[model samples]
Target: MKRVALVGMPNTGKSTLFNRLTGGTARVANWPGLTVELASSRILLGANMVQVFDLPGIYDLTGGAEDEQVAQRFLSEAKLDAVLLILNACQLERQLALALQLKALGAPLLIALNMVDEAKRAGITVDVAALSEALNAPVQLISAKYGQGMAECKALLTGIFSNESHQIDFSNIPSASTLHQTEKQLFQRSVHQPPILNQSATDKLDRFVLHPWLGFPLFVLMMLALFQLTYTLGTPLQDYLEAGLTWFKDGLLVPATANLPQFWQGLIVSGLFDGVTTVLTFAPIIFLFFCLMAVIEDSGYFARAAFMMDGLMSRLGLDGRGFVMLMMGFGCNVPAIMGTRVIRDHKARLLTMLTIPFSLCSARLQIFLFLSGALFSPTQAPWVVLSLYLASILIAMLTALLFKSKFKSSEPFALELPPYRLPLLSHIWRRGWGEARDFLRLATTMIVLGVVLVWLLTNYPTQQHSYAELISNLLAPVLSPIGIESTLSIALIFGFVAKEVVLGALSVITGHEGQALATQLAHTLDPVSAYSFMLFSLIYIPCVSAIAAIKKESKSNLYTAFSMAWSLGLAWMVSFIFYQSARLFGF
Candidate 1:
């Protein structure tokens, strides 16, 4: 099969085009020997199947940014038939430099001017024939969003395979001046923009969203609403899922396993089913959260939020990019740590990676929401969750500040804020469904295993004094000071493997699931100890995946060891203080 790559600068509608062309049948594949993952899919174009890879968005081919380096390396390594260079038509003049760079590398390039509809709205015009002649390549005007000019674009891609291709040589990057001049000449000859462009909706919204004083506060409100909305909407669905799972267990699983020995039945029902299903109920909440987050990100407000927070971030020894990675950490710390590669400075990258684990990932969010809802009023539950988010940011900032002097970053930060547009339904569904699938996958696999282990430990050697009690009693002295009880200590021990298993392990050990488990937990602890447990979970060791990511990205066992030690020590101190302080205040 012929191979082609879709390459473009950030927010050039490149991924949109890739999805449109490949019908969203893409899978993420790690490029050989590279930490970055690219989306690749096989699509039938003109009776021939071709592998189309969507490369990470980059500003320049030879830039020092991690994404740029990945793009450069992939192009150099992959034997490709052609490169589909997608450029934003509205930003044609500025983007022409990349086109010229690719051209100079002797790459077989088929240029697609995407977002032409948006360009036309801005009163910008591009002469396709003139641009093609100037660049000596096939240039097609396309609006990948609405499927405009797709046929012509696909035809151009198909035609490219007819011509023989040469290896992309990146060693001969043109001088900046020459590339700039050629880009200018090409833009002048083929593109036209209105003398006075009207102010866009994005600009109008930014007046308030990006206001100096109101921006951060507004961001806080947005976050508050986001969490509140997630709970308000997702709680019902979670309840329904829990009910359905309970029905399945009582109605089907119990009957199916009735004939089995008592031990086997207990292992399958009480251990496996109870533990796994408890965690699985959070799948709806996780999906809903990611969907809302996708809306914020796709609307272009996330970039503006990063811009608004850059000053404070700089003081904390990070830039807006680090802030973005920290927000990404809310989804999962592993990828967020991997995302630190975008930071060019080694110290800053390491710092960002170290700080990301503090962000409250969805896995921990499950524990917080379950506990807060079980312990607090509905009106207060959202606030309790929001407070944890605040704690996450505060902790991350403090970590950065503590390590700033040791690992300083002077690399200048620059970011692009794309125009605010309504997010596509397809995109939203993909984000939500993908996250839900991942959540379920984790629950059924690792969480199930962890729960079974918890069940075994709790059920073995005699019902009067199980192995779990023995182990928890052994660690009781250390955990007791921090307000964590023996049973919770068992969950924390398995939590080191994966935070998703915490609730499952608790359910298995407590002999309850879902709301019943929450009720049981209410009997075992009060608000003070509950909050203390949440804090400890928030600040303590990350899951095995995140630890592996830190080790791989930082490439230092000592640094990885330090990260674990720092988080463990900090988690204990913070939790102990909060728990003790609350008790003193008569909470």
Candidate 2:
């Protein structure tokens, strides 16, 4: 298949165009540097299937940033039949400089004047024919978001394969500053625009949302509301799903397998069904969390939050984009770790990856929500959950500070805030389903394995001197200081597979579900120990998937081992302090 690469400056809607062309959810955020890795998908154009690669956004091909290097390497390494140089019409003069740079790369180029609708709305008009003549390239006006001019763009791309590739002389290519000045002259010659004093709705809203004093407070409030909605609206749905799963197990699976061997029946019903059902019950919360995050992300508020938080992040030798990736961590650590690619700095990216494990991901949050409702008062539940989230943020910040002196800082941080638009329901659904689907895919395999292992440990050997007991006894001396006993320690062990499995593991051990399980937990754990356990869970080594992501991103076993050792040590120390301090106070 022929290859076509989508190349453009950051925040020019290039990813959105890629999604439209390839029908893949490559994570379209209204912020710069979201596409840190190369994303490729094949699409049938006319009679031929062509592979379209979405390269990481870069300001200059000649620059030395990580993303720029990736793009340059991809162009040099990959077989490319054509390059689609997308540009933001609203920022034509600035975007054109990158386009000019790409033109000098001597590849067959097509200019996609994206965001033409936004430019028009801003009272700017571009003379496409004149601009095309000047650039000596085919300029296609497109709005990737609304699906306008896509067919024409694809048709043009299809025709490119038949034509000879365009080649330009690199020797005559102008310098960056010279190209910028030339782009300005070209823009002035071919485009007419209104005066710069006019304020759009985005500017008006940013007056408050971006205000130094008000922005951070509003960001906190928005995040609080997100959690509040996740609980309030998701609880009933979660209950319904849990009940449905239980009914399926008792109503269908039990009777269907009644004649099977007793051991087989126990493995099928008590082990697999219960464990899988328990994790699935939390799907509602995960879905809800993603939906809310998608809304915040699509509405462009996430970028503003990053901009607002840049000062605090810079103090820790990070930047606003790292903080944005941290916020993404609250939904899931896997993607958040992947999202760290947006951080152009190698040290900052690694630091951000290290901090994400402390972000109270949805799986950990699910466990906390379950425990909070089961053990604490109604009014206290919200506060308990909120406190854990706050603790996660505090620990992540502290972790950054602790390591700030060790790593040198990278490039200066700059973020472009896209205009806020109402999030489409389809976009929200796509993002929500995407995350939920990924969670299920990971959870199904890991949870089942974890459950089967725990079940084998507890059920085999006639339940006397069970493996859980043996392991707990072995670790008791070490765990006792943190107020964690055998049962809890065993659950924590399985939690390494996935955090959601911890609750299910406990339920399996006690032969209880729902309220019965809650009652059993209450008898086993005091408030202080419970809180200490929560704290430990919040800071412990990440799940297997997260560890793999860290290793893949950092490409260092030592760093990955360090992450585990540090988190485990931190968890133990923090939990021990909490437990011992509370006991000393006679709580």
Candidate 3:
């Protein structure tokens, strides 16, 4: 069995290469010791059909960082037939470090110079032969994004597979410093002009975005505007999707079920079409959110926001890099999990992952907008969403404080502010497509089934009445203190799986109980209780996929369980405190 491995530095297009090679069956995974996770995939090699491993992205194999340690351990253990090291042509100096270290493991190696398109665009030239001689390995240049030179690189690897006997080199790696000496020399001699310093442009923009006194307030304002825009824009698209689903149900399902027997009818009308359509109807909102985040990321202002918030994070004993993941979490948690690998500290990385769920993700925000509008006044809407975000930040602060007091603080973050680039619509559209695909593939597939299962359990009755009433009553005693001794809270609990289902569950409960149920709930539970309910949702176990990710990333049952338990416990206390205290204050 021929086994090949691929390794590279972060953002060197390692994943892009993996996607190109392995045909995109990649999944996120965690290191053995650290909670930080990475993405990997398998690729099929030429005629021999050899196996290839796409390893985690790390800057070096020095074992100084958790991801690096992981790559190092894998390299040492896996008896790989050949290793492919990807290096970003633009960032040659940094990406080369990991490559040299891998070469020292005495394996047949090849360097795929990625981002050649960007390199040429940036006016950087490379001699592939010189680089090959420097590292004593076959070197080829390719761009995974544009597909330039990728075929030649594949052919070269095919040749390696055919020969099955290439010289292995360790001349570039050194035991003492974790880097080979020649690797150091080549980088030092790689004469590229220093990075462009956009001082004037930065000074102008910082006046608003990074102004010491105005920065935080500006951030709040921007977030408020985003929420307003998202709702205003996303609502129409959501309405269209919902309308389409309604038509499909009425025209397609009703006709299809008219002639079928109950068993076949149920399978088509409820299990298959009903389940898929319910989840797919939310695509518009998800699509909008993805597009927005992609635009923010490409413009380079997202990183600037992290820089602006550094002091706040430092005050709470966390680093700014954690904010990067938080911003990503709002779009989807999958990328957020992958983002944590950027953090170098093991403790900080775990803490950040633990707290990310508490941030009101876009999925949660969709539910909030619906419920907040249903419960609150027009003037109070912004405050409702604003309050939820503020609560998320506060909870994050508390989580950080608890973590730091329990463990040592990580190294402070130092972020380089890259020059802002205009958003390329093609790139933004592609990134958005990737995120939209994730929402549908990873989340919706399970969520629709979950919703259908919940509908059955809640709709069907065992004793005198439907199970929904029985469940509400059983939960009422526990929920009575918070004033939601009814099915809404029952649905909220089920919502812990994924937030989109919250609306469906609420619709089921409220529909079963009728319009009178809303009036009754409104009277029994004041605005405070509704607000508390939303807050409880802000901090709970994420969807099944996120939980699975936690298991994979922690690689330990205890940490995963601890993460789930702590989140649930904290959410309960926070909700209880808000509800009970608001009742006491007579709100």
lDDT of 2 by residue, 1-587 (tens): 78798999988888889989989988876777777788989988888878899998878767666677788778777767889989888888677787777666667778999988888888888898998888877889999989899988988877777444333344554567878778888889988888773888999999999998999778778877887888899889988887887788789989999999999998888888776777777788888888988899889898888898899989987888888888778877887897776666788888888889999988898789888877888677878888898899889989999998886676798888888877778778888888789778967787788878888888868788787788879998988999887567878998998897897787778777666677888888888888988999999999998999999989999999999999999999999999999999998
Using TM-score as the measure, which candidate wins? 1
For model 2, what is the error of residue 45's alpha carbon versus the real structure, in angstroms, after optimal superposition? 1.1
Q: Give the TM-score of candidate 2.
A: 0.94
What TM-score should be assigned to candidate 1?
0.96
Clashing pairs in 3: 172-180
Model 1 stretches astray by more than 4 angstroms = 25-36, 163-165
Candidate 2 residue runs with Cα over 4 Å from true position? 163-175
lDDT of 1 by residue, 1-587 (tens): 88999998877877778889988733211111112458888989988889999887777876787767888899998989999999989888789998888888888899999988889889999898898988889999998878999999999989888555557887788744568878888899999999889998878999999999999889889999998999999999999999999999999999999999999999999999999998988989988998888788778777787788899999999988888888878888987898787778999999998899999998999999899999999999988998999999999999999999989889998877778877777777888898889888888789888998998899889767999889888989888988999778889989999999999999998899999999998999898899999999999999999999999989999999999999999999999899888888988
State which candidate, 2 or 3, has the greater TM-score: 2
Per-model TM-score, in order, reads 0.96, 0.94, 0.80
Candidate 1, pairs of clashing residues: none
* lDDT values, one for every candidate: 0.87, 0.83, 0.67
Error of 2 at 418 (Å): 2.1
lDDT of 2: 0.83
Best by lDDT: 1
